[model samples]
Target: MQILLLGGHGKVALHLTPLLLKRGWNVTSVIRNPDHESEILALGKGLKGNLNVLLSSLADVKSAADAQKIIDTVSPDYVVWSAGAGGKGGPSATIAIDQEAAKHFMTASFASPGVSKFLMVSYLGSRKKQPSWMSDSEWAGVVKVNTEILPTYAKAKQEADEYLTALAEVRKRDPNASRFQAINLRPGTLTDEPATRMVDLGITPKGRGSVTREDVAIVADLLLARSDTEGWIDLVNGEEGVEGAVERVAREKVDAVVGEDVEGMVKRFFPEAGLKF
Candidate 1:
C-alpha cells in the first residue's frame, strides 16, 4: 500500500515511516522544513522500501484550494493527517496548522481521486463527548506554560476532530456518495518509552492509560492494512501483545462465514473479519 504522511518529522511519523517501509509499503512524507529531508531519508537507510518527500507546510496553506493542490499532485492511496503547530507556535499558529489545515485536508480528500483512506493520529480527548481540549483537564499544566497557545491548541484539535466526524457521518449515511474512508485513532498520554506493541482499544477502554509512540505507529500500520476497519478506536497500553491483540479480534466468531474465512482476512491484514459493521 502507498501512504502519504503529513508532519513527517513528528516523533510518531518518523518511527512509522521506517516500519511501513520494512513492511514493503510505499511512504511519502509531506514536510514543511527542507532541512529535515535528510533526517526523514535516514529512516530508510539499509531498509527495503520507497520513501518520497513533498515540500509543503500546512501553515502556508490558506484554504482548501491550497491543500487540494498538494493532494492532487501526490495522489496517494492513503493520507495520514499528522501535522501540528507544536509548542513554539502561538494561538493563531495552532489554529492555522491544527484546525484550519485539517479541514482543508478533509475537503481536499473528498475531492481528490485515488485517495480513499484517511488515518488520523488524534488525542484521546478529541471526541463528541468532549470536543474542545479546554474541556478536559489533561492539558491543565500545559496551559500554564504557554498560556496563550496551549488552550488554543486543544480547541483547534477539538474543532478539527469534529469536522472529521461530520464528514465521516456523511460517508456512513451514503456509502455510495463517496469512496473515501476515514478512521481516527485517539491514543492516551503518549510517552517516548519503548513500544509494548500491545493496545487496548474501544470507544472507551477501562483504566488509566498511556501508549508509546512506536506502538501507535504499529497500530496505524495494522489499521492501514485492514481495508474493512473504520471509525474511532480509543487506544491505550494493554496486556496482549500487538500481533496477539489483532489475532484475537480476527478469531472471534461471527455469523457471516466459517472460521477459515475470518482467519484468512486477519492473517492478510484485515480486521473485524466476518463481523457486522
Candidate 2:
C-alpha cells in the first residue's frame, strides 16, 4: 500500500515506518525540516529504497493546502498521523498540528472521490470524556506549562475526532460521497517495550502498564487493510500465556462506575490486564 506518515520523526513513527516497510508497504515520511528529512532517511539504514521523505511545517497556514496537494499527488492507500507537539507551547502547537492539521489532512484525503482510508492516533482515556485535563490537576504538565491559557491537548484531540466522525457521516449521506474510510486508533500510555502486547495499561493518575509503539502500528496496519472502520477504537498488547477475557462495552457501563470505582479498577488492573476506560 502507498502510505503517508505525518510527523514522521516522532518516536512512534520512527518505529512505525520500519514496520510498515517490513510489511512491504511504501511510505512517504513528512517532517518540518530538511535536516529531519535526512535524519529519517539515515535511520531507514538498510530499508532505504522503501521510503520517500518530504519536508514541510504542518504548523503553518499553507500546511493544509500543501498537505492536500501531496495527498492528491500520491493518492495513497492510507495516511497515518502519529505526530504530537507537547510541553510548554504544546497546547497551541497541538491545536495547530493535531486539530487543524488533522482536519486539513483528513479533508484533503477524504475529500477525494477515490481515496482509501484515513487512520489517526489519539489518546484513549479521554476519547469519551470532556477536556478534564485542566480540571483533574492530575495531568499537571499540560496546564502548568501554558499557565494562563491552560493548553488543552486532550481537547484538541477530542475535537479532531468529532470533526472526522461528522465528516464521515456527511459523506455517507451523499450518494457520490468520498470513498475513503477513517478510523482513529486510541492506544494507551505508549511504551517502548515489545513485551506488553495487547494488554490495556491502566490509564490513570499513577499510570499503569505500557503499550508499545509496535503494538499501535499493528492495529493501524490491520485497519488500513480493511475499507470499513471508524470513530475511536482502543488497541493494546495482551500478555503471552495470559488468555484473559476483554470485552467491548456500551457507554452506559462507563457511566455506571463511581469516581472511587475508577480509582479502584485502575489500581487493581494496573498490574494485571490493565484498566478499562
lDDT of 2 by residue, 125-210 (tens): 44433233224543343344323443377667766766666555555555655565667666766787773445542222321124
Worst 10 residues of 1 by lDDT: 253-262
Candidate 2 lDDT: 0.61
Top candidate when judged by lDDT against the true structure: 1
Quote model 1's TM-score. 0.79
Q: How many residue pairs clash in model 2? A: 7
Error of 2 at 111 (Å): 1.2
Error of 1 at 130 (Å): 6.6
Would you estimate the TM-scores of all the predictions? 0.79, 0.70
| Candidate 2 residue spans exceeding 4 A from truth | 43-49, 88-90, 128-151, 200-209, 239-277
Q: What TM-score does candidate 2 get on C-alpha atoms?
A: 0.70
